[model samples]
Target: MPSKYRNFRSSVPWIILFLEVVLIILFYFLFSDDDDASGSTNSYPAFQDVNHMVIFGFGFFLTFLKRYGFSSTGFNLLIIVLGVQCSVLIEDLLVLLLQREYKDGLQRITKAAVSMTAVVISTGAVLGKANPVQLILMAVVEIIAFHMSRSINTTFLQVSDNISMMHVHLFGAYFGLAVSSHFSEPSPRTEKNASTPKSDLLSMLGTLFLWVFWPSFNSVLLVEEKTKAIYNTYFALAVSAVTAFVLSLLTAKDGKFRMTDIHSAVLAGGVTVGYAAHIIEYPWIAMILGLLASGTAVLGSYCLQRCLHPALKIHDTSGIHFTFGLPGVLGALAQVVLLVLKDWTKSPRLDYLVMIPIGAFCLTISVALITGFLTGVIVNLKLFKTIPVSKYFEDQFYWEFPHLAVGF
Candidate 1:
């Protein structure tokens, strides 16, 4: 017990040190965004990619839980997700203040309220059992997806035309899940685990919330076009509903659908639609394409699970690059195709062809190089390491204690 106590004592300081480092990095990005040494309003807001906080944080949390051998409890996952979201909001506020931008307190509160509520709901669903391998894979995938998106933004299209951002979140979820399965331990409540009535109810509500707000989340900081956004939202909703219902039925046990797949599908379907939402206007065409996109991506994800992952030994759920980044780029290019086929007045063949090579180059090479390099640096430096591999399952390590970090 004395050794344990001494170990504990040393850990607290290390945890504090890690938190300080994370906070400092976050602030650096915030400060950089606000940087205008020449005092020009023209400085593009520093760190427009505040979404990285969640992607990285979520990846880190998974890594933390996995390295410590914790369970992937619903509640635990929820807490980590909430913490990441909170960090984003805090970062956002810092950015807003730094830029001297004014916004309504009510709007800010509303966002904060909903975000917090989501965290609470997710936390309530906890059941611990983490996989470190999976978590590491997740971090790797997210970094790749982010870099790919960044590359697309830089190389393809005018600032107003950038749509790659929507793909990162979508793909991240898929890739992360894949990686988790490969490296993480199985949840105790596997398919055989019965869903409590309460769990089912909560899952239903959570699905609805994500479905409704998905469009807002996707287009939040994009150039505003309310009419286009609304059309895209409904189109996405219809496709997601149809796909979720079908997948649920196909995977049901005793006539009751597997709620996990249902919830994940809704989110995935919404994200799949995000890629082409801005460019596609016709509802029917959007629905047809959305369904195709959802089905194909899901099928690809399933195949990745059984064949590619097992054979290659590459556990990755950083679906951001795969699901959204690549698919969305294709979706955008598809828009150009639709126009060519549907209209007789003019041809955009040259522009459309140009996008194909450009999108491919950006997603495959640029994202891989940039994101891979950064993630490798972080992992090699052990910037996001944690301890015990098993202790993390207990709330004490992840939430209650600060000292259980790696090397402590």
Candidate 2:
């Protein structure tokens, strides 16, 4: 890299920080006087859990790469902070412009966290291939697209998805995959992309955090059916974890568990039950969804990922498609099934219930792909610093570390 390019790359974080400070000032002036903007105290605990998942769970989960632990956790924090602020501002501005009202503070923050969760999930797909500058750029654009797609899903399509099945998981997965496609190189997988035993252990800690707190994520926005949502999410997660272990044993060559499969497939139930978390009245139904999600996730991780890399030339660094994409689609299907079964006779808008989820599913994919590809183009432009293929998945490219830090 040229001296000028290095200088520019070094200044990117400062530039983003300055802009975020300015936005914070603008937000204070815009919403300071509105008494109703502050939300209820009751939501604090759930918000805390979701925040933990977004920060710690996601940050640690991406640290499975041997040489990229610092970048994984550090960039995860950076992208999340940027995504949250941008998402909240965009959502508030949109609501104020269209609805003549602002969302309450806790609600806005909670939703923003959820929105950023999608962005973080997307980050997993392009993890080692993109620079921090590129990731920040991608996140800002993604936040805007995320809110727009969500509005189209909820307001226009009237999708009954309460847990952001299509809006968050599916959209994030495909968007990231599309961006990964754009970032793909002809080079084959390298040793740096593989995880160390310590790193895998750290990543599994993340999995446990996500596994424990996911019910709160699924039920955070619900009121009437909060308990039901929690219950369903728990049942589904339990089944998925067991099923993931079983599949890992069956699929591995020596009957040993692959930590990669455990890291992702164990969480399949949470993504799978998201669509109907609040509405799945039976534990059996949730468990069935869990089983299916685990199978699909394991299959995609073990088999489909290899084929996808060559056929589509998309390098999914953390198997986001298996963890979030396929399971998300299954969740959407589960939503459709539940809606049809429950509303077929009682509700006159059965068609809306059935078709809206499907429409939202399709719409999310379209929006995510178009926006993601466009963002990829912008980030890949000569204006920004790009991660060279040789430097991919290595933290020393971006991080300043003392000798002692590497001793462990």
Candidate 3:
């Protein structure tokens, strides 16, 4: 970094910031046109919702660790901004190849927002272990992979509705898990990975923020069904939150509550019903999804966090496999089933409608898994090796902590 840009004490990674500025300038001046001038300022509210999800939701959601708060939130801030900045260029290029049109810079920004949401989820899976540079690399590669899979699903596969189910959640979850699986093993779950009361409070705040705004998150692109989307997503989120609270104790040994439930299960509603949040006309369906999704996610978290990882020797820090992966799968499957059911009510043939989402699901999982694994392998190569094992989850190595962080 140049002397002028340096913060003296804090390591700002100014080069990345400079690149971000250049990318934002290019997105507006380059991809958009003065002649067409098509866009709706009406979409600004939804744009804000997406921005919060990326900037605040993902950042705090990963801040559940005690010592990793700085890395979790700071690195998140850095990578997501970069992800969104780069996504505009990448998504616009994909759209042009398909001869599609976008309204304006604001709408393009919302699209970029969802792209960042996907990248942040992947970052959560590999949280606390990756350096800022590695995370930047991960964000760039994951954004490209997310776009390719999402573009294919929307275009060639014609999988309509539940865009987040297949594109954002499933791809991000699996990709991050695949990457984390190859990263160095977890250091013992010491204070290094543990959360303090303050951190838990921060995590809850993130959870509530995501829970409250999720209705808007899923409803952003709804043309005529915005109200239905809002109602279903809202109801589903409520049901899931209550269910996660109850089941967190019921499922735990000695009937004690677990932090994992608070961290992951409560938000299953947003994930499980996301695809059909607008499509489903009934609140009952939404409630059923929330109940089932959160319940299943917690149980999966229990198994993966306790049994499966111990048995298999795979390292997952935040239990991404359950929180994101299981819910994503359930949501995608439910969406496909609903799509077919909706088609059956209107049309005679079920085969064609059923196969499309199923195929997209299969294709997306394969692409995410393969691409994610390869990305992980590349990062693990000598060229991009991660930090030392002893220093895996702590942030003092990367960031200058407060109150004389270095001398302490």
Candidate 4:
């Protein structure tokens, strides 16, 4: 707790050491003399792409806010790093609990990346309000709950759906929103959401990173279907990105586009298509799904930020409900129609829907809400203590910043 020992750089060694120890234990337990543990070597490229998406893609997406840029990126890194480490341990433990063997190497890393993505998404709801420590603790709880619910869904219930929409998108969005209830009381509805031209350009970098690598995320470990998966994701994103901007200009009060629309809603296609990305054979259908997803998300942002914020009495810094949450639910719903109409029950391939997935979805919803609420409660307790309001949304409280140039 000494000031000298508690600085950011000083924390690096312990974090690295902890991660190394966990990885060693996992590798030890999972190491195999036979090559059976390792799946196709092709997953490596996808794994690296997913890592980038989790670290840079999600981090910069939240940096659209003006003053809190550093905290957005920095805290995102912290929570994700911790979440990735915890993911390996927790996911493997669940596998062992189910009497299944743990997978080694890239498979484990892929799982970690997906789990970390979920944690990152959840952080969006409470961005700039909580310190990195609270986010880390929240990830610890959420990841476990996510894994448990995931296990019950996959192993026992055997629902059919892709990993991202069900496991990452839905779980993260709801969990973060639930925690946002306790993140803070609404703060006079500030114009802090406004972005400068430069910030808009910077935000596009996040958007593009996600746009390019999302195929890898949706297609990971799908060796046979990876190409088709990538194809659908690409088209879906293309349509979403274009539709979001068009809708933004059409719907904006000024008849101009909202930068926030470009920043977040453009990504709705990825969330929408996630449910059926690999399964949908037609590119046109993917585009339509993207359009549907972006339409609701882009249009709702105008209304939700205006009406829902005051009504719900909670401020969601990221407007994540519109970007990730609603689109994710839409993806799930659209996939159900595809399943029944396409007669997926007849196919040998089963993805996320059946009775079990419905249960898993409901379970994740319940667990995430309860866990997030308790996390808020625990962080608020004097033992952990929430960050003071004056200190919120500023980097000065934690980071050591040099004197800035005028107007910077």
- Candidate number with greatest TM-score: 2
TM per model? 0.58, 0.94, 0.91, 0.88
Instruction: State the TM-score for model 1.
Output: 0.58
Better of 1 and 3 by TM-score: 3
Off by over 4 Å in 4: 1-40, 160-165, 189-194, 344-357, 404-408
Estimate, for each residue in 265-369, the C-alpha lDDT of model 1 and write its tens digit: 555544555555665667777677667655555555566657875675444422333334334444545555664555535644666645653554345344434
Q: Please name the candidate that would achieve the greatest lDDT relative to the true structure.
A: 2
Query: Of the candidates numbered 1 and 2, which has the greater lDDT value?
Result: 2
Candidate 3 residue lDDT tens string, 1-408 = 344224322443565777778887886765764333334567888988888987898788888888888888888888877787788888778868888875577777787887777778888777888777678888889888888888888888876634733358888888888888787776576567778889888987888788878888888767788899899988888899889989988877888887768679888888888888878978999999999988888888767878887776667777777877888789889988888777797867688778787888888888888988998888777555456777778877766657774665
Taking the tens digit of each residue's C-alpha lDDT, what string does model 2 give over 235-316?
9999999999999999999989888888989999999898888888789999999999999999888676677666887888
The lDDT values for all models are 0.44, 0.84, 0.79, 0.75
lDDT of 4 by residue, 143-186 (tens): 88788767766766665435523457888888888888876653
Candidate RMSDs in order: 9.2, 2.3, 3.6, 3.8
Using TM-score, rank the candidates from best to worst: 2, 3, 4, 1
RMSD in Å for model 3: 3.6
Cα distance off (Å), candidate 1, residue 146: 2.9
- The ten-residue window of minimal lDDT in model 2 covers 31-40
Write the number of the candidate with greater lDDT, choosing between 2 and 3: 2
Residue pairs with backbone overlap in model 4: 159-352, 160-351, 160-352, 160-353, 161-351, 161-352
Candidate 1, which ten residues in sequence have the lowest lDDT sum?
Answer: 117-126
- RMSD (CA, Å), candidate 1 to true, equals 9.2
